[model samples]
Target: MRYAFALAAVLCASPALAQQPTAPAPGSNHDARPQFDISTGVDFERGDFGTGAQVDKIAIPLTAGVSIGSVRVSAQLPWVRVTAPANVIAPTGPLGLPILVDPTRPATRTTRQGLGDLRLGAAYDLPVQGIVASVRAAAKLPTASVDKGLGTGKADYSVGADVAKPLGAVTPYAGVTYTMAGDPEGFQLRNSFSGQAGAALRLGGSASAQLGYAYAQNPIEAGEDDQRIVGGLHADVGRSLSLGVYGSGGLSAGAPRLGGGVTLGLKFGR
Candidate 1:
């Protein structure tokens, strides 16, 4: 559950991303090592999931991991803020499992914030010829308060694989993930299939840019299909620190009309 709230300013590229390159392009395959990072960002979106509602969300995620050969393992703790039309029943959870209040009941004005589901995940990388293949798996814990509209209060899981080929400084990649969210409370959620593909271009030694598209099937029976175009840039400020900003616009009625985020990274032992 990403591409949070949408606001005019959030859609504008940030000045922080205007630095020189000191590292590889963000999101490109790289050597693994023990590291820790904390990312925080704000997003504002409208007409999310065809709810005809406006939303503002702030998310903070912290991750720490180590690599063993080509394997990497990490854990993430996430917190979020959500403000939505009380009548639309915006349910939320981690990654692909979003929860909503029982819509059959009368809705009220809603604004809530707190922890999202905690997650532990791992990834493996395999290089074949000039193409690199990768697989990832994660498990979500029921950590958020369902009454606060922060989560579905159920455990969830997802697994996916993708391959990428580097063509000089420009690399293209594609991948898909299947999410399984168990039923919680009175609602039954369907398993979701989502996919993403795009290309990333590294600019000199200090900056990189990327463009991509994402598609996801709604987990709810009547939920609208989710489709959007997303892109962003990353800039290295120094040897170990970088800044990133991204934005997305929906291509379908079921998706958010607009959404975006910014992230700051400080890499160690990379």
Candidate 2:
């Protein structure tokens, strides 16, 4: 009976050991894997102007990466169709003074439909053993039309760092990001700083939940900040497949919005 009990304990621990994230020294591990995550969902959001709009975005995000020993390299591509209102700010601006000053312009509706921005970025994860810490840089390439109510078609830059620490039953992580505008004249610049702090809960085997808060500086457009509560879930649907969902809820009165997204992914390699 003693031998049988020991065998059973080992069997139950095997799965947990296999699912744990790689644990390197306090500052040694840096790269993740080449994983593809795709999510298509609707965002019921309100703009800085306190207007409500529902836009459906098909986000195909791909993260191809590899960590050698403790060094890491990875890239991610994000395509989104962020929808506001019909006559909303005329997509990209430089509007006539009349339109810019008129309070009724945003209230008008227009017949326009199309894609938004295309983002491509690369990151080098810094070496942090035991605990994980890395700096990431990204760029947003304008692919949508800035004219016909599509997008700004202007490039943007972002820089940030993230840190993760494991404690007992949970892992706590936090990070901050800053965005710079390219063409402040032709398009709206998002001059904001966002920070998120969350903890991960491991559930027996292949599932986990992360809940945290994200706060952003007041957006360029008054009354629009990304301050919200965020919750995310990850589950291994199969041996090679995983699913995730995330939701954000606004915290303030100005254009505070609520939305959620779902992700489906297939991973390969070790």
Candidate 3:
């Protein structure tokens, strides 16, 4: 029953019903593969908190990509809104109860209702035989609120490598990313390093699943590290459409794991 529920959850996670560019970007193929490939999806994530922690947030991401020669570019814009039910701290005093207040007042906290982060970057393939290797560099623009629930308001940068190889029916991949956080205005967070590894499995021609792990450094002195194991399912539903569902769980209490979400993806052109 647990396996069945997990399978069902994977199937409904994201839209993998569309076709993607088989070959690398233009100059990447030394043969000019495809001009562009675009996909857009939304993820509804539920995160589990610690003993007395509360965290519930919804994020919608709109993404698109272009391949101009060996240079491939993709952009992701996310809109997030969160509500932490038990995040409220109240005063416990004499006459029955003290002052109790909802830290995240949705009605009054709608001010943080805009785009979260803007990511822009490009990937350049490194010529290799029987394998896929590339270097990627990107910048995360401060578009979301670090304060009032909107954005971090601090710009960040990331550089990493993408490597992939096929094994029987699965194509495994690994990557490492480092980000530098800018100064804070309201609640500017600290900078950290993140590492991720995953793979895409070909289940016939219209379906695939990506499973991986991610680890991030903790900026808070009293907190543990952030570790995540993520999985994503993609399937082609139509000629130019796809669906996906993604989920992640915390391997240990060192970080806030237990996260799951759903996505819908669309693609057009060859």
Candidate 4:
């Protein structure tokens, strides 16, 4: 089975509110300038992955990005550690989920640690009838070593779009993504589709909360699809710093049973 502890990693990095761009003030020049941000965080998750063997994973990801006008570009790289049965593979794809290569293979718990595949992404914002919309594209580079089971040893690509509408203190949003998987030796990974729907609620002051459901098609033919409930609370510290705490619970065997993590973000430029 494919366990999505890696999905928790992605949620920890980008909260729902963070993906919504702020509109510029009327006749303001600030929106035309460039803005930069950097973020880093550690995420941990443990699950059986439906293979009758425990799997634990830790990921430390560092990301940096610049936004010019309504366009943004970013890159992320993560150090990952995985402990699982020898039949399981670590950091299998773009989301860094571990895969159960062969459940019937002899079981020997082992640990592997190394750099994960690097991901580069770009997005463009579009405002339409009071709704914030954006289109995004991303590529995963085969930077991690396949021998160490840190990646698929092939590049992957994805495209997606998101839209959010703000009403008073609440914003409702939804997004869909399509990914083209790269086949590795002895494995035929299938393309997949994923989506999320959520709402962010303002809790007064500098804090906000969000809750969402995520679903994804399983790329492996033997596993069930992935489904989970994800939520988080985020707060701004002063002007440039922000912090968030998030968690997820799996609704299917293809996802981690339970996972949570914290993240810190810093903003620069303007």
Candidate 5:
């Protein structure tokens, strides 16, 4: 459950799916060159995750990235807070497997806060006819404290590919990922697969909206699979500033009942 929550936070903090780069606003001094980007945002989610007791989570993530030619690289680190039953241990990093201290033990309210795992990722844009496509890989470094239930104490990795094609004012895209879960001391986590499909609609020259659905296989054998509907609104404010607001609603007990967040991004260099 904690793993599910952490992953949800990471997903929510990200920009909308299928969003294509748009031209700078008219009269703006935006440079048409490869650039470095930085973004930060806060995300919140609440859910029972099939457990009888409710859990709440908050994450504030900082991310930075740069594009060079057809390749892009990025890093992200987040601060996370969790409040839940004592039996429900909270793991601070994304893609962690949920671990219950004692499923049979009576639960008590508990809270944990700390820095989360560090994530590093790289991607290569694939040249394709009439479509944007990319292949990506990411790794989660175990940085949080396992003793404090802030991480799995082991690393995780994932690889995926996505493609988007523009059709008039709408861009439709789909992606699939395979994650290798880390097995902790007493737990055997299962590798999982996740996928998303979405379309982004250009609202004008500077704004767009996206709607999507996502599904993930459960990393825990006894846990329910995760499913959700997601959407977002994004806008460019100036030559180098952008804003995004997004929301999600769970379609399964494995996901947050509802979640939302805002992100602000800045771009530098030409």
Candidate 6:
């Protein structure tokens, strides 16, 4: 009977020994995999810009990536809609195109729809024990119409690092990023910095949840800083397939009041 009890204990703990639960955020190690992933989602946000003026954006975004060993690469393409007061940018076309005018335009509301910027990024995981860390970098290309107020017409650069530690079924992580933007006419956008901190819980063998906070400094001179609370979940639905859903609530005036996204992915390798 004693031998039987010992055998049962070892069998029950063996599965747990093979895998540790971790968070599901990109750039964090809690749920890192050496695989290819393709996902898509739509996101929307509304913000009050003061004086009864408001702005809104809706975006459909897609991302594709592959990770092999310690290195990962990805790309992004987005379709976006922007609605703002004409005082910001007046409409010159039927498809919601924005035409930046002199200081004399009317304050009527205008809307524009177009492709957004394209993005390419990569990350490399460091060789470390216990806590895992990665170097991250990305670039945003001018793919959207500048006259339509969809893209900056210039490239943006970003670099950052993220670190995470997994403890049993939970993981905690943090990261910081710095972005450099190109200057456009009438706007002197500054280089900016942002930070993220989060914890993730593994619900079972195939699902996980995370809660976190993100803060970013304003890149435009007239823009305010943004801080937000974020939460997300990830689950496996079938062989080589998964789903992710995430949302954010703004903590500062610079952010949209509410925002969320969903992603379905096909994964390989891992």
TM-score of every candidate relative to the true structure: 0.82, 0.68, 0.71, 0.87, 0.86, 0.79
Clashing pairs for predicted structure model 4, backbone only: none
Candidate 6 lDDT tens digits, 1-270: 000000000000000000011244333333354677776655555555222467676666667887766777878776778788654531111011112332454667788887776777777878777676778777767777766666557677777777777787877777676767666567676787766677887798778887777666666556666666767677788888777666666687654466665666687764
Question: Which 10 residues in a row give candidate 2 its minimum summed lDDT?
Answer: 1-10
Please write out the lDDT profile of model 1 over residues 122-213, one tens digit for every residue.
77876556567777776778786767766667787877776766688987766677878768877888888777677778788777777777
Highest TM-score: give the candidate number. Answer: 4
lDDT of 2 by residue, 1-270 (tens): 000000000000000000112111123432353333332222222333233443222233344544444344444333334344444432221110001112333644445545544444444555445666766565556665655445444566666666777676677776666656565344355465555666777665767776666555544565444345566666778877666665555574431355455555565555
Q: Where in model 3 is the C-alpha error above 4 Å?
A: 1-34, 48-52, 85-112, 186-191
The residue-by-residue lDDT of candidate 3 on 19-94, one tens digit each, is: 1112111113433555454545444433333324444445566667766556678777766665543322111000
- Model 5, position 94: C-alpha lDDT score: 41
Q: Candidate 6's error at 105, in angstroms? A: 5.9
Model 6 misplaced stretches (Cα beyond 4 Å): 1-34, 49-52, 87-106
List the pairs of residues colliding in candidate 6: 96-112
At residue 179, what lDDT does model 4 achieve?
A: 73
At residue 87, candidate 4 shows an lDDT of 71
Question: How close to the true structure is residue 69 of candidate 5, measured as C-alpha lDDT?
Answer: 69
Q: Which candidate order results from sorting by lDDT in descending order?
A: 5, 4, 1, 6, 3, 2
Supply candidate 1's per-residue lDDT for 184.
Answer: 80
Rank by TM-score, descending?
4, 5, 1, 6, 3, 2
Q: Which of candidates 2 and 5 is the stronger one according to lDDT?
A: 5
lDDT of 5 by residue, 81-179 (tens): 878876665554444244345454347788888897788878777766666777888888888766556676788888877777778787776777777
Off by over 4 Å in 4: 1-30, 92-98, 102-106
